[model samples]
Target: MAKRISQDQIAKELGVSQSLVSLVLNGRREGVAEESYKMIWAAALKQGYVPRGGMHPMHAPDVQHSYVGVVMRAGLALAAQSNTFSHVSHGLFTALQHLNISLAFLGGEGDLDETKLFEVVSRRDPLLGIVILGEVKEPFMQALGELELKLVSVYASSPGLCHSIVPNDKQSVEQLVDHLVALGHTRFAWLGGNAKLGRNRLRLAALKERLAARDLLLDDRYVVNAEGAERQDGFDCAAELMRRAEGQNMPTAWVCHNGLIARGGLQFAYLRGIKVPGEISIAAVDRTRACTEIHPYLTSAASDPELIGAEAAKLLRSQPEEIGQWNKMFIDLVAPSLFEAGETSATRPE
Candidate 1:
């Protein structure tokens, strides 16, 4: 039970105004350095301090507890079944406890009814609003409206309904490509492209634009569209692509859509006895369950699943008036944090 640190401490430490500290702390700070805001976020996450709903931005309070409802997208549950899920959930729950908020997980196939979900959330003692952890279905959004919950969208936003916290898509992809390009990788292959949902599509599109700017465009032969939601499909897609790669010629590197596909690609390459990087460098855009818990941890875009949870919490507490002010609130987390080059990447063979 750590004593709650005030926003004033953050403001003083950063030599910024209390207002700005509150803004950045509450996930609303714009026009500030990304690294600087992360410094504040690190402190809050460390201290486990979630600001209470309807609390004045600058005032510190002494109430010991509160609660928020969280509606996670369906895919996260399946992914969470991974070994990394426990680690990520622990991080998020630890932060929530420090803030005195007990999370009530709602909105999955088990109990996805917006109407029923809201009924349960409303029954929670001292409930404020709900946090939509991933994609929001009409039912979930409708349920929030039924409860009159101050809804928060964790990743994507619905303009006037809630605030959002997502990775900087174009910027993150551009930075990743820039890093790989700097490594002398010109020819590239991708595992998951052509999805119109969520951020991967945005990342993939930006990857295209950025690479083309460098006079490096992926030929039709270098792309793989994995259209299903299973690891086997990922493996099959990567295997199929490798077959294609053999037919066309030598590509310098392969950047999968996310780490799952990256894992699949790695396995596919390993099975084929194609020494990664020694043969084809492997990388991915998103960082979850991709590079960890395996030999030669993946090289990928850094992602904090807990951040997704945390952002959802923030959006839940924000008021409608505040929501209108939110035009794509995002947390830019891309510093090219490469973990364990892992023999997956190396210099191009002459």
Candidate 2:
């Protein structure tokens, strides 16, 4: 009988680790760099090394890889915050239970380096799909795209790269504007986050469009963007806005990027002896209990994170078995509903 062709032989021949050869042979290529992946596979083919189970799915008949992996783009600290991603995860967990599909959390960005990501993927059965909880950079996304696995992103979109489920910013902003206008408040200020992010940009733009339609101008001085995404950034930006609007027309209503920043704004109000909804009304685009941690709960126009997660789960589960069978990229947009307007948002101050 001919000697068995083991992973060790292929690894030694290609000047790579036996573990790496094993990972590639097991069909976990999501974290492997494209060039390295091709080289390892080409080497395996040249050496006529076949996996103990069978050939690669791309080369052999399709196998049912039922497992799905979830990767959080944010590090552990940021992900821990009760934000959209966390709620989406709750929905994903609940929906996946009925789908009868197993779920695996690969790790957050900080937890999984290249080798660790590959190791995690290898340890599991071949994954059918991956659910990305937040926005990822181009290079990171490119590596995932190279994998033959399907991808679904929650609260973000990668355009033609993968399917996405996101909140409808335009509709949500419209609802918020309608409410503020009904309160007889025309002037508005945006306490926002980094503009480089598409989500932030979309929210800001939607606010501008809605305000313009209502014949209200969002003056440049009133739009203060936080230097960072933390609570302190919100406080600093709010102070800056107050200074800039000093002796000038100030916006009566304020809209924040998310509950975290919104909470920060409320703190600034307390420190400055400014009463929320009494002196200036505050609202958020995303909801979190932290917004309510203060006296008045935050009013928000936001989608249900659980619903978004559930929708993402369905989308991932509906993916075709064969990677080649995927259709044009799918995008599902869920609209936001107003919550607790009476608590934080009030009639415009005279």
- The sequence of per-residue lDDT tens digits that candidate 2 reaches over residues 143-183 is 77666467887778887778888888777777778888888
lDDT (tens digit, per residue) of candidate 1 on 235-266 = 87688786787766667777776667777777
Off by over 4 Å in 1: 1-64, 75-79, 83-91, 193-196, 314-342
Off-target runs (Cα >4 Å) in candidate 2 are 1-66, 74-79, 100-102, 109-120, 291-295, 319-324, 332-342
Q: How many residue pairs clash in each candidate?
A: 2, 0
Query: Which window of 10 residues has the lowest lDDT sum in candidate 1?
Result: 330-339
* Native-to-model Cα distance after best TM-score fit, residue 283 in candidate 1, in Å: 0.9
- For lDDT, the strongest prediction is 2
- What's the lDDT for candidate 1? 0.63
What TM-score would candidate 2 get against the native? 0.77
What is the lDDT for 5 in model 1? 73
- Alpha-carbon TM-score of each model against the true structure: 0.70, 0.77
